[model samples]
Target: MRLEELMNEHYDEFNENDLHILKYVLNHKATSSQMSINQLAEACHTSRSSVHRLTKKLNFAGYSEFKVFLKWESQPAEQESRHTEILTNDIEATMKNLADTNFELLSNKLVSARRIFIYGSGTAQLTCATEAQRLFAVVNTFVTIIHDQVEFETMFPSMSDEDIIIIVSLSGDTPALLPQARKLNAKGIEFISITNLKNNKLAQLSPAAIYVTSSPTATEKGAGLASFIPFHIAIETLIRHFAEYLNV
Candidate 1:
């Protein structure tokens, strides 16, 4: 069975703390794979014993074995190599990736969010705004894509526990967004980050994050080549999921 299937099967066994650890593990398995049990405990704000118990409850022999399973589940499959290549060079391929990722993001968001705020900067900011507007039209959901630091700051005071923030940054290292993200966390607002850099500050701050592989760094005077296909894919996936949730 798939990891998700297994998780569902054992969902009833998890308590609030267990669920918190599980959510973090699921969203961050790619980086969690590299972490030791102690490191994971530190990241999750839990104890090593809790981590061990959770892994055993999930039917893994121990933390190392669990990490291996998580690694397999989190990384892109070998088949994605072809799609990645297409994203780099072919418009058609890029469009397909966008559609797929968007569907996934929308579905997950629809299930998870009460209210949603999207934060982005540079080209990504435009993408978030467009998606937020599109989703607001379909569902009676609140979706805001904040651009400037002042605008972003002004809105946070009104957020409550039921709100979630979806932050988009290609580099996963936007310093300006960190304060807002940290503030949201302190206020019990959850986050979903769309970024290319794995295990960066943005990912560390976010309770859940999606990483998309990107091309190598650009040369001086050349257009920065961090691919936006993954971001588009995630947003499109999210919108479709949101529509389905409304229908249901």
Candidate 2:
């Protein structure tokens, strides 16, 4: 099951804060897997105890044990071994970390939403939104991508408990969208966030998060290539999961 699906399966048991922490972990696990408990707490703006509690809630022995599982789960299979090798360099490492995190997030959740709404801003925003739209379509699912804030609100009233909203951002800190995300949270809307940073404000707001780790764009020519690869891999995984769900 995907992270969303997992959440849906256990939705009634999750409190708001629990959902928030889950989102942060799912979004940033790729990078978080590399961090210590202290670092994870600092990134997520929570306490070490909170992190431990979350791990326990997820039925793990602790953070360290969780990381081990994450590492094992992230390895590529034989067929994709060659492709995985291509990512052996620094860029590959960053992207592989992201892909691993995304896989965990998708596999853990069990979302049964009737509809999904995707939101993105700036130039690449539409691209990300379209990618999600395309992937979700394979499972005969419904999705709406919104570019402007005005249009988003117009459709907000129509959103029900069965609907989901997904937001994508590299910084995990988009000024215009932050307030809106908070507002939606206040309204009890469930959200899945895809972002580059782990503990950023957006991740904090989302109920579930998919974190991508990529090299710095300004530092190297191909630095950001691995960053976007995680998103592509995530969408592909989501599509497969959705297809499996439909078949079942």
Best by TM-score: 2
Give lDDT: candidate 2, residue 76.
46
Residue 175 alpha-carbon offset, candidate 2, angstroms: 1.1
Which lDDT tens digits does candidate 2 get at residues 1-248? 23433343355566666777777767765676777889878887878888787667666789898777655544544443233444444344444545545544543343566677888865576687898788777666768898888988888888876777888787777798898888788777788877764446777677776665543433234333334665565556566765675673
Put down candidate 1 lDDT per residue, 82-198, tens digits, no spaces. Answer: 435545643443344344343545456546767777777676556766776676667766677777788877887888878777788877777887777789888988887776634
Instruction: Give the number of colliding residue pairs in candidate 1.
Output: 14
How many residue pairs collide in each prediction?
14, 16
- Model 2 vs. true fold: TM: 0.58
TM-score, cand. 1: 0.57
Residue 247, candidate 2: Cα error in Å is: 2.6
Worst 10 residues of 1 by lDDT: 93-102
**Residue 35, model 1, lDDT:** 93
Error of 1 at 228 (Å): 1.0
